[model samples]
Target: MLTKLLITDDAAFMRMTLKRIVTSAGYDVVGEAANGQEAVDLYKELNPDIVTMDITMPTMDGIEALQEIKKTDPNAKVIMCSAMGQQAKIVEAIQHGALDFIVKPFDHSRIIEALKKASDR
Candidate 1:
């Protein structure tokens, strides 16, 4: 089955870019969110197979959202996305139950690879 996805990013361009890449790669994008709080809300509503989450956002931030989602659904599949060198946050995300972390500016292969890994879990 094609994986369903929720994309959460504060930047409109990033969301659009990821949507395009994910769609082209054959995953169904079930929802989109502009912040961590929204991501959590949408995750509950959509319950997608995977989520791609940006580290920094207006309301909650990705780490917090990842924790919230994990709390609600221990098996939630989330992949953290950060800019080049947010190493500490990435590690925190993984420790907090994120399945994988991907560095941006968005690589198609990396996104797909992360999705595949998340789906496997």
Candidate 2:
């Protein structure tokens, strides 16, 4: 089955990029959120199989949203996306239940690979 995915990023361009890549790779982009708060809300509404989350965003950061989502549903699969040099945040996200991560400036392969890992999780 196609993996249903929720995309959360503060930037519209990044969200579009991820949506394109994920959809092209055959995963369904079930929803898109411009901020972490929106992400949290959408997660509950959509219950997507996986989520691609940005570490930095207004209203709420991905880490906090991730935590909130976990609180809502522990089995919710989230894959964090971040720019380079945020290893600490990435680790924290993983510790808080992020299934995997994809660094920004992402190529098609990395996005697909991350989605694959999230689906497996």
Candidate 3:
């Protein structure tokens, strides 16, 4: 089965880019959210197999949303995405239960690889 995915990013362009990448890589783009709060809500509603989350967003940050999702479902598969130089935030996300992370601007191979790995887990 194609892995179901929920993509969360405040930027429309970022979300569109990721949606294209993941869908072309053969995963289903189940949902998209423009902010962390929306992400949290969609996650519950969609219960996608995995999530691609952005670190910086209005309403709530990725780390907070990650924590919220993990709180409701410990096995939630979340892969954080951030621009270069957000190592500290990435580490905190991992600590909060992110399955992995993808650094932006995204690499096509890396995004597919991360989704594959997260789906396998």
Best by TM-score, which number? 3
Please, what is the whole-model Cα lDDT of each candidate in the order they appear? Answer: 0.93, 0.92, 0.93
Off by over 4 Å in 2: none
Work out candidate 1's RMSD over C-alphas. Answer: 0.7
- Quickly count the clashes in candidate 2: 0
TM-score per candidate, chains pooled: 0.97, 0.97, 0.98
lDDT of 1 by residue, 38-80 (tens): 9999999999999999999998999999999999999999999
lDDT of 2: 0.92
lDDT of 2 by residue, 6-106 (tens): 99999999999889888888989889999999999999999999999999999999999999999999999999999999999999999999989999898
List, residue by residue over 62-113, the lDDT tens digit for candidate 3.
Answer: 9999999998899999999999999999999998999899999989999988
Clash-forming residue pairs, model 3: none
Task: Please rank every candidate by lDDT, starting with the best.
Answer: 3, 1, 2
CA shift of 1, model 3, Å: 1.7
What does each candidate score in C-alpha RMSD? Answer: 0.7, 0.8, 0.6
What is candidate 1's CA lDDT for residue 102? 85
Candidate 3's TM-score reads 0.98
